[model samples]
Target: MAKKPDWSKEEQAVQAVQLAFDLSNDIQRAFRVSAALQDMSTADMVRKVLQLPYRRARARPRLTVTLKDEDFELLAQKYRLDPQDRAAIRHRVAEELQGFARNYLTDSGH
Candidate 1:
């Protein structure tokens, strides 16, 4: 008699949901390559990509800032961020500044 393999609780739970799809060879190959590059299973990659919330593009106000080397270095160290990743740095700074403004306004009863 063949022995049955054991599965972890998480694996068992995931196994309960089964999704099957038929794709063209080219599409399948593309998904396989993408999944391999990301070091994830095809199913997991598909699930993650499908689960992301869709957002429509809209124009938003932008802020521009010029920083000296010393100031940039200080901000990078304080945020524990990479200076080369300008987009991430900008996003973090914007979020922090917005939060600070909100807190200050609330505290001042404005």
Candidate 2:
């Protein structure tokens, strides 16, 4: 089932357009992102581009990272999260960074 969007989300879409308009020196490029995000969830669109996981209920990806018990504990304490939650966050962030590098470095023509 498709989720209903809230008003704040709609506003962010508008804000994204405004940002594009402000930043993009070229009208065509500003219009391009604006149009592309139209009829789509702006939050999701930005998150996907930034490689962030969806905010909705999602099955956690299975990713292994070796961390010492002390390190894990420290992270959990600092973030006020359980070990599992900390692991999940770390994995998601790492994946996002990796994807960003791949997309930006390998795909973009500098």
Candidate 3:
């Protein structure tokens, strides 16, 4: 006779919506470290990061900018950005620039 597998209720619940993917070693390490720092499981950290209500402080048209290495370094220093993540650096710059624009427009009555 084959032995039956044992599963907890929480495990069974997660199985219903669980998704799996292969991540690079660096990203996996970062995820695990972040989860440990937050005192949460990697699964919960992933869920929180990906599951969003999608709220924005203001609606603005999207724009892209190209920065040279020196320029990026300057921005990273000024903004204290994470140099390893280009996408995150871009996002932080965009948000800061948008806020400045909004404040300037309001002050100038535009």
Per-model TM values vs. the true structure: 0.38, 0.24, 0.38
Angstrom error of the Cα, residue 3, model 3: value is 69
Task: Give the per-residue lDDT digits (tens) of candidate 3, residues 2-94.
Answer: 888898998888787657889899998888788666666666667668884432321343455779988778888877876666777788888
User: Which residue ranges in model 3 land beyond 4 Å of their true spot?
Assistant: 1-61
Off by over 4 Å in 1: 1-64
After superposition of all CA atoms, the RMSD between model 2 and the true structure is 16.2
Q: Sort every candidate by TM-score, greatest first.
A: 3, 1, 2
**Candidate 2 lDDT tens digits, 1-110:** 98886669668877754333244456555444553445334444555656777444223433456777787777767656687686565865576668986887787584
Clashing pairs in 2: none
Candidate 3: RMSD to truth = 15.2
Q: Tell me, by lDDT, which candidate is best.
A: 3
* Candidate 3 clash pair list: none
TM-score of predicted model 1? 0.38
Q: Assess each prediction's global lDDT (C-alpha) against the native.
A: 0.73, 0.59, 0.74
For model 1, the local distance difference test gives: 0.73
* Candidate 1 displacement at residue 61 in angstroms: 5.8
Model 2 CA deviation exceeding 4 Å by range:
1-84
Candidate 3 weakest ten by summed lDDT: 52-61
